[model samples]
Target: MCLLIAIIIYFLFILFLSTLLYPMPVNDSGITRYRTIPWTTLILILINTVIFVAWIGPDMYTQEAGASGTVEYGPSPDYMGKINYYGFRETTLHEGIGVAAFTTFTAMFMHADIWHLFGNMMYLWTFGRRVEDACGSSRFLLFYLLSGVIANVGSVVVTPKLDDIPSIGASGAIAGVMGAYLFLFPGTSVNCLWGIGSLIRLPIAVVQLVTSQQAKFWRWTVSVPAWMLLIWFVISSFIPSVETIRSDQDTVGVNHLAHLAGFFAALTIFLFVRKDLFLRYLQGRSL
Candidate 1:
C-alpha cells in the first residue's frame, strides 16, 4: 500500500511540477481494453496507493509495538495485535486473520525503506507489462498473487518460530514470471543488465556479469529447456545462507524457499489452469 501511494504521489508531483514549470502533459496511454486503459492496472495502482498512504499516516487505530513483538497505534483505544515475519512485534490495522498469509501477499508491494521500493518497482515496471501481455491481465494477477502465496508458505515452512522479522518484496512473484517465460515463450528475448565479478571465486560473479548475453532462453535450451531455470531456482531455495542474512533481526531473512515456491506455483498453474486450452493446443501441434 505504501509503495503504491509513493508512486501515485510521485506521479502527481511530476504532473503538477511539470505543468507548472513547462506546461507539458505526462505520458498518456494511447490504448485500452475499450476506450480507456485497462481497469485492472488502474485498480491495482489505486489499491497500492491507498494502502501506501494508510501505512504511513498517523496511527489512529494503534501505536508502535516492538520489533519482535506486537505494535499498537491510534487513540480510539483500539488495538489489534501484529507480528513481524520472524515473530517480532510490528504495527498494522488488520486483525483476526493469519498475519502470515496477509504478509505473504501484502508484503510483495511493501518496502522497509526507499531503496527497497526502488529496486522492486524497477523490476516490476520492466517485467510486468510483458507478463501481462503474454498471460492476459486477469491471469497475470492470479499468477502474481499465487506465486507470492507459494513463496510465503515456503518461507514459513523453513523458518523457526519467534524469528519475527517480516519479509516483503515483489521479487518472488517476478521470479515466477521469469520461470513461466522460460516455459511458455522460449523464443522471447529477455535483456538483463547483469554483471559478474573477478578471477577469484567471487570472480565467477563478475564473469557471469561480463558474459551475460540477452537471448531467448527458451530457444537456447531445447530439451525440457524451460525446466532448466526452474530447477536451478528450486535448488537455491533450500540454501541455509538466507537463514543468516541479517543478524539484527530474529526473523527468517531472505526466504529463498518462497522464491522457489513461486516458480513451481507459476509452472503448475500455467500448465494446469487452462487444461482444455493446453490440450487443444497440444492436439493442434501434434499434426
Candidate 2:
C-alpha cells in the first residue's frame, strides 16, 4: 500500500510538472454582469481547498505512532479506509440506491492528492465565476451538486465492473462549469499560457526584439475561442472513453466518461440560468 501511494504521488507529480510545457487556461474574456463578486465560486473553491488541506491532509501525511516513542509521517490507514468507505463505489451502487447516491455528494469534495485538488480548483476558478454569475449563487450551487451526482452515475454506468474502485474528484463538476461557459459565453475567449517557448528554452530575446506587442504576447500566451476549447474537452474525453470500453481494459485511469456526462448534463443550464439570460440566449443576442 505504501509503495502504491508513493507511485501514485510520483505519477501525479510528473503530471503536475508537465503542465508547464502545455497550454493552460489563465483567464477568460467572459464577464459577470449579474454579480460583481462571484461569492459562490469563491466559497466553493475555499471549501474544497479547506477540506483537502484539513480533512485529507492526515490521509496523505499522517504522523504514525512507532516504537521508542517515535512518530513518522505516512499515509494513514484509518483515513484511507474512511475514503473507501465513503467514496462512491460499486458495492454502494449494488446494495442500496440511497446510500450510493449519498456517496456521490461526499465524493465531490474529496480529492486524491494536492495535484488532483489543484488541477480541479484551477479549472473551477477559470470557468466557474462566470457560470455562477449567470445562474446566481444558489442556483449555481444546486447545479454544481446535481452535475456531480449525474457525473458519478455516468461513470458507474460506463464501468460497472470495477467493484472496489472508488470515484472521487470535482473534475466532473468543473467539467459542467466548462460546458456552461461554452454554452452561455460562446463568444468569449479563453486566454491560456503557452509555455512551449519556455519548455524548449527558446530565446525570448528574438521575440522581444520584434516591435509588435501582440507578437511578444503571442510568444507566451494564446487566446482560444471558448467553444473550441470546451468542445475539444468533450471530444478528447469521448475518444479515450470509447477506446477504453472497446479494448475491454480493466486498468484504472481518468474517468473520461464522467467528464463527457457532466459536459452534456450542463447543457441543461438553460433550466438553471437566470430567466433574463436564458431569454437573451434564446433571442440570439450577445450575452
Candidate 3:
C-alpha cells in the first residue's frame, strides 16, 4: 500500500511539473458507461508515460557536449540516432516511403520531453475515455493511429520546406480525440488547469473541492463546455499556423497545422462510432 501510494505521488508530481507550459484537462463532466472501462485510453497513456520516463527521458541532455547524463552535453548520438530513425519527416514520404509509413505509427509514441508526453496524455485521458466508450476499444485505437498519420501528412503537405525536420509526439492523435469529443459530447464540461508550476496540482485541487475545502488551487481550474474549449484550441492552432507560414522561419516547432488536420480528420468518427450511437447522432437524438 505504501509503495503504491509513493508511486502515485511520484506520478502526480511529474504531471504537475509538466503542465507549467500549457493548460491540461484533468477531468470531464460526462459519466462513463456502466461496467465499461476505457482500457485502450488508459493503455495508451501508460505506454506514452513509460516510453518517456524509461526509454528517452533519462537520456535527455541540453548542453553542447560532455557526457550522456551531464547537463552540459547534448543528446548522445544513440539518442539522436533513435530520433532520426523514428521521428517522422516529410522527406521520407517520398524517399523511403515504407519507413515513412512506419514512422507515422512510431513517432506518435515518441515524445521530445516529459512536458510533451504529459500534455498529450492528459488530453487523451480527458477526452479519449468517452470517445473510446463511444467507439469501442478497437475502433478508437484505429482512429487514433490514423489520425496521427494523417496529421503528420497534413503537416508535411502544409510546410514542405521543413521536410527534413522530424516531428514527434501524440498531440495529433489526442487532438483527434478532442475533435471526436466535440462532436459526440459538445456540451460536456472539461475541467482544465491553467496556472503556473505549483499553482496547478489538479489532483489535490480536485480532492480539496470534493472535501469542501477551498484552496488557492480553485483559481487554477476552469470548467468549460467541450465545444468552447475545442473551438478555442482549433482557433489557437490556426493563428499560429498562419503566423508560422508568414514568418517563413526555418526552424522546427509545434505542428499547429497537423493539429488542425487531425481535428478535421476525426470528423470521420461517424465511421468508428458505435452503430447505435451513429444512428442516434444522424437522427438528431442525444447520444
Candidate 4:
C-alpha cells in the first residue's frame, strides 16, 4: 500500500524534474551477460519466505526456561528484527550465526515477519531486475551473497550485541545490492522513499526511486554521503544507540556501513574485471 502510493508520487516528481534533468541514455553494455536473476537475491527471497512459513513463526517468541536460564520471546512484530525481550534475541542465536557467514546464504529466504519479507522482496524485485540484467547470472548471484557477508560482518563490528541477540533479515545484504547498483550506475535514476506518516511512504519522487533515496539523504546531510549511508546503516546494526535507546519497542534500523563496504568490495571486483573500460568511462565523464 505504501509502496504503491510512493510510486505514484515519485512519478509525479519525475514529471516535474524532467523539466530540468533529462533521462540519461540507457546502456546495455553487458545485455546478454546480465540477463539472469542474481541468485543471491532469489535465494534470499526464498529463504525469508520459507523461514516465515516454515521453521520459525510468530509463536516461536515465547518463554523456554530450563536449568540454564529463562528465555522469553513473544512474537517479534518488527520486520527489521529488533525484538525487545531477552528471549526474542536468544531464540534465534544459531540461526543468526548461520546467516552471519556466507554458508547460509539461503537464510535470506527466511524472514521474521510477513511485512519484513514483503519489503525486502519488493525491493529485490525492483532494483534486482537491472543488477541481474547487467552483471550476468553467476556474478550477480554471488554478488548478493558476498554483499550479505560483508553486511553481516559490518553489523558484528558495529554492534557487538548482535553476537548474542539473534538478528535476522536481508537489509544488510540488500544494502550491498544498493551499493553495487550505485557503483555500476552512479547517475542511474531511482525512487527515493521516506515515512510520511504511519503506514505511509512519501515518494521523494524520481525516475528511479533508489537513486532518489540516496540523493535526498545525502543532499540533506553533508557528513554522510549517500554511498556511506549504505555502509553506515549496516554498521549501526540491530542494536540501538543512545539516540534510539529511548524507543520502547523493537527497532531494526538499516545497517549503513556494511552496505558501503560491501558495495566497495564488489566495485573492486568490477574494477579488476574491467579496469580499462571503467577508467575510460570515468575519463569520458570528466571530459
Models 1 onward score TM values of 0.50, 0.81, 0.80, 0.51
By TM-score, the better pick of 3 and 4 is 3
Model 3: worst 10 consecutive residues (lDDT sum):
193-202
Best by lDDT: 3
Q: Is candidate 1 or candidate 3 better by TM-score?
A: 3
Per-residue lDDT of candidate 3, residues 184-243 (tens digit): 888788887755523545676777778875554445566667787799899989888887
Candidate 3 yields a Cα-based lDDT of 0.81
Model number with the top TM-score: 2
As a whole number from 0 to 100, the lDDT of residue 165 in candidate 1 is: 46
CA-RMSD of model 4: 11.7
* Candidate 2 TM-score versus the reference: 0.81
lDDT of 1 by residue, 90-149 (tens): 222134335533566667765443444444454454445544544566877788777776
Name the Cα RMSD for model 3.
5.5
The models' CA-based lDDT, in order, is: 0.48, 0.78, 0.81, 0.48
- Which pairs of residues collide in candidate 2? none
lDDT of each residue in 1-287, candidate 2, tens digit only: 99999998997667546655555676786667875588888898899899988888666767767887798777688678767867877687678743665888888888888878877887898899888888988999999988888888887677766655777898888888888888888889887765563445355555565755655433455677878778778888988888767765544487787788888788778889989988998899977
> What's the alpha carbon RMSD for model 1?
12.5
Error of 4 at 213 (Å): 34
